[model samples]
Target chain A: MNILVLVKQVPDSEALVQVKGEGSGVEVEDRYTLNFFDSLAVEEALQIKEQTGAGTVTVLSLGGQKAIEALRTAIAMGAAEAVLLEDPAFENGDEYATAKALAAAAKGMEWDMILCGKEAFDDSSGIVGPLLAEFLGIPLVTTVVKLDFISEEQAVVVEREIEGGKEVIKAPLPVLLSAQKGLNEPRVASVMGVMKAMQTEIKKLDLAAVGLSQSEVGKAGSKEEILRYHRPPERPPVTMIQGEATEVVRQVVALLKDEAKIL
Target chain B: MAGDVWVFAEYQAGKIRKTSLEVLSKGRELAEQLGSGLGVLLLGSGVDGLAQELTAYADTVYYGDNPLLEKYNNDVYYQIIAALAEKEKPHILLAGATFLARDLFPRLAGRLKTGIAVDCLSLEMGDDGSLIARRPLFGGKVLADVVCREGRPQIALVRPNTFSLPDVQSPAQGKVLPLDVTVDTSQVKLEVLDVTRMAKERLDLTEAEIIVTGGRGMKGAENFQLLDDLADVLGATVGATRGVVDNGWRTHDDQVGKSGKTVSPKLYFAVGLSGAIHHVMGMNTSKVVVAINKDPQAPIFQYADYGVLGDLFEIVPLLTETLKKEI
Candidate 1:
């Protein structure tokens, strides 16, 4: 089994985002990390390789050279190799264009299974995994919570979560699955692993090299555009209560009826 | 550009979801702001009467009566809505950020080659004649304002409960524009084999009027029974913070946080959870936020309308009993 895991470098969850100018979108000054969810994908792929002991795990990413950190993180987590579709040109690609680029990269790989975070932290569209699967003309399952090997060549069974409940679906190999949080608990890289990861080779691919153009990858390729960006209005000071539970409830109900008027 | 603002009035079973009305209300406001007509796109089998209800808030109502659209399919609904938007170039497109909307909007935007802002918490008109949309990023840790600069007739999926539904209903005298949309069923590849509803009564957390949620301080999964008891008595749904969900005590659907569902219940009761921004984003829209936590330093009180400094284990049970007795 040759499992491919896709990861993206995102602004760290703790980093503050600022919107500048009248319509400029969010801008983060400093600090970024591997998407918290994609880290889980990397962990899951490494676990699959370790447990099976037969498959090679490849970590793929689309971002700048700085995104090599994301690939290295996956490598330190035990991925056999790393592929970075890194280029300044790939910047600002919307979900559709990003998925297309990823699909193009996958077209050249000898992948039997693909796993990715359900969505990138920056975009949060959650459409790329399925969209790339569509572009690749393969079966797609998203929000996968659990996975089990049914057979080597025939199929794999996984739980796909939806709104209310989850569906356990068995699909043939070479399928694409997007993982959600809690699919697996990711382990921290050891000193030795980190040292080894520094030496791992990262294959870089640009737009034209990936069978695409500048117009096909970035803001130009996106169907949607960010017209304007701004900060949310500061919320009013909270109307706090200083009394017993019963008294507080009464005050809350009053405020809701009179001030908030939602009830 | 010539058409009115269109609200996707989503109805499941017979009754319309509250989010649908909220969208209509927001769309009506936007249409008025833009000096355009208000229109609603209603799709479902046996939904002709629902058209009247939608028309109560809209100037025009377009009904697409098809059984295939009764239960939403991403491809089917996307095709229908995309075709409608093409024919009727509405200035602004608004829909609830429900599961149906999440599935259809991005795909439809891709198919139409338009831009969309998803899960917007607030929508307002910009000074420059563009629609400014506020959405959360970094798991609701930060609220990012976004706008579609280039797309014709900007598209957005409004988060549930962010906007209030207007009490004043318009006269149900709008024109019913029944659309004759061709359905290519073969294009819909995914089949819904079955829908197993989660076990519970009342409403889901996202759709609930009142939500009573507990966190890890509640102790164990079994302790959630008290929260459920309170929810039952108040005609509310039970929700949990990420702490509880991560403990494998409850399903992720029950989680109230940035990664989980964003709920805007009328009244939200937070028990034992220290308010993380992620958790607060889910319920911050509630008209009344009452928090019960032993630690005064818990961040929940900062956002909470009412706070109780006591053991939630004791307070929740007492409150539940007292409310049950009073009501």
Candidate 2:
């Protein structure tokens, strides 16, 4: 089994994001890390390779310089190779265009399975994975929580979440799966692994290297144009209801009825 | 670009989901604005009954009936929806951002080579007849307005409670129209083996009008019963903070935070949890926030509209009792 995982660098969940006054974009905190679900994806791929003991695990990410850190982190975890798809032309692409470039990259390599984070922390679109599957003409089963080998080279059965329930499904090889939360507990890299990752050269590929064009990726290739970003309406100060428990409860309820009028 | 507005009316566990109706209500408003017809797409086996319910809102109900579509098979549903979009060429396609829609609509848009916005907070008609969808990013801290400059049927998946349920039309106008869909069994790849419903089915947080959430101060897993009792009185759902869920006091499914689900309930009751930024990110979209913590300085008070300082045990039951009488 040849396993390839797609990872992304995103603002840390705890990172404070402030919308700029010009409405161009928000100024995000400098903190960045591998997306939570993508870490699970990388972990699941490494575990699959470890269990099969045959196929190689390669981690791939599409971003600027910071994306390499995500790849290095994945490599430190256990991936054998890393590829960074970075180029000015590939920047600001929507899910459709991003999938187009990633599919081109996948065509340049040989892999039996592809795994991606269910959604990124920054965008949370959850569209790129399925779009990549469609672009590759492969079947996709998303939000997968469990996987079992039916045949090492042929097929696998997976369990995915649904509304108030879960569904167990089977899919053939050369398929794409999006890792949901609870898939597995990710492991931290050892000091040796981190040192080895830093020494290893990260392969960088531009749009041309992936056989993509300027009009086929990034903002040019994007279908939806983001006009601007703005902060949500500011909330009011809290009305503290002090005194006895009963009195405080009464005040809160009365405020909910009179002021908020939501009850 | 004169075309009709299409809505994917999702039927789950035998009834049309309320979120579908919510989207349809908004779709109706959009259709009226564009001076176009409104239609609903129903895909399932023996769903004519559900289609009838949809007619109260939509003008035409287009349903595709097949055993293969009995349970949502991704490939089959995608093929049929794409084929319909190809044939009908509707101006806009709307769906409720349920788990299934979130899983399928983006894939359909890719196949159709169109633009789509998910988890949209609001949808507006641009001057150029394009779809302007404003959606939250980086959780609910910021909002971005997006538009599809060039796309046949602009697609959007709206969050569940963003729009109110429409009043049922006195005389239902929708007429059921069976779509032409041929399922090539050979083309279908994935096969579902089994589906298990949850033992205790609570109101989905995204759709709940009110949520009463407990935190570390709830004490333990058993103490969640207080939240449930409050929720019962308020006709709300129960949710938990990350601390409570991480401590195994509640399942991750019941969790609301940066790591869990984002909710926009009309009224939110915060019990004993510090107003951590991660937790606030998920529920700050709420209309009215009520925080009950012993510590007045807890961070949640900053975001909450009303804060009741007291022990949760004494306060929760008393509040429930007080509301039971006042309401």
Candidate 3:
């Protein structure tokens, strides 16, 4: 079994996002890391490969030159190899075009299953995995928490998180599953693994190599164009309450009833 | 067979979810703005009766009743919705940014080769007959104003609690139209083995109106009972900071921060948690924020509407007791 783990690199969760150029763009500090959820995907893919003993986990990502760091991190963890889809044309694409490019690249690879985070921390659209499945005409199960492979049946059963609880689903191989929270406790890379990953060569693919033209992969291929970005407005000043616990409680309850009127 | 504004209603547990109604209400507003008809699509088994709740808001309620839809099959729902959308060519389509919608609408848009914005905070009509949707990206720190620069049936999945439910109309003038859809068994590959929703009364954080959240300051798993007690009294759902969740004091479902669920509730309580930017990004849209922390310098106090600088162990029980007496 060959598993493809789709990953993304994003600003550190603790990093402050700054909007620049009159909303033309936003900039974050240099701090960067693999998206928290995508790490779960990496962990799940690695666990599957280790337990199955007959499969390979190759991490794939689309981004600028920095995204290679995320792939290397995945390799440092346990992936056998990594591929970086980096090209000027692939930048600024929305979910539709993103899946289009990924599907284009995926067509050339042999895989039994594709895994990715349910949503990336930056966009939080949760669209690519399902869109990729649609582009490939395969089934997709999202927010997956548990997965088991039925090798003999050539199918898999997955437990997916739903609105209220969970659903156990059965689908054929070559399906796509998006990792959700509680999927697994991701493993940290060891010193030896990190050293090995530092020397590994990563394969890079551009629009032409993937057989996608300039129009269908990036900003030109995107459906929705971001008009602008505005920093969220700050909330009003807080009304501080001090004194004894009883008095503070009284003030809060009264405030909720009269001023805030939310209670 | 036609409507300019279409809302895909989500029905679960025998009732239409509140987010669907909220989106319907917004759809009604958009429909009025365009002076066009509003239609709602309801697809599920035994959901025909739920159309009555939607009829007040939509001019027409289009329903496709089938057993295959009893539990949401992503493929079946997509098949049914995509075919109808192709035939009718709706100008705008809206659905709640839900577990179902987040998964379904993107695929729907992909198949239709159109544009969709998910987890939007607001939606408006653009000058070009397009939908202008404001969404928070990079978590809640940034708000983006975007539009589907080209396509028809511009799709958007709006976050719940962003809009209010419209008042039900007396003598409902809306009509119900049943759809003729056949279940294509060949396309259905995913099958459900079992479903477990442990507690019916416990609400999902996204849909909860009031939330009482704990953080690392809660100390340990045993202390979350204080929050549970307070939550029990106020009928509010409990949430946690990622730190507490990672510390094993709470489940990921109870986590409300970046990397967890983004919640927009009416009233939010930040208890024993020094607000981190990552945590605040998730619940920043809350209408009323109340912070309780012994430390006066906690950053959470900045974003809070009401701040009580005191020990949560003492303040929480007293607040609950006081609230109970006052009510």
Candidate 2, A28-98: lDDT as tens digits: 99999989999999999988888888888898889887899999999999889899898999988888889
| Model 3 ranges with Cα > 4 A deviation | B1-3
Per-residue CA lDDT of candidate 2, range B37-135, in tens? 999999999887888888899999999886778888898898898888898899999998887888888888889898889989999998877889999
DockQ of 1: 0.38
Q: Tell me the interface RMSD of model 2, in angstroms.
A: 1.4
- lDDT, residue B95, candidate 1: 89
Per-residue C-alpha lDDT of model 3 across residues A1-263, encoded as one tens digit per residue: 89999988888777788899899999888888898888999999888887788888999999876689899899999898899898989988988888899999999898999999999888889988888999999999999989888888989999988766888989998899999989899999999889989998998988889998898988899899899999988888999999988988988999999998877
- Residues A14-56 of candidate 1 have per-residue lDDT tens digits of 5677766764656785778788778878887887777777879
lDDT for A29 (candidate 1): 54
lDDT of 3 at A7: 88
lDDT of 1 at A240: 55
Q: lDDT score, residue B20, model 2? A: 91
Total backbone collisions for each predicted model: 4, 1, 0
Best by DockQ: 3
Clash pairs, candidate 3, are none
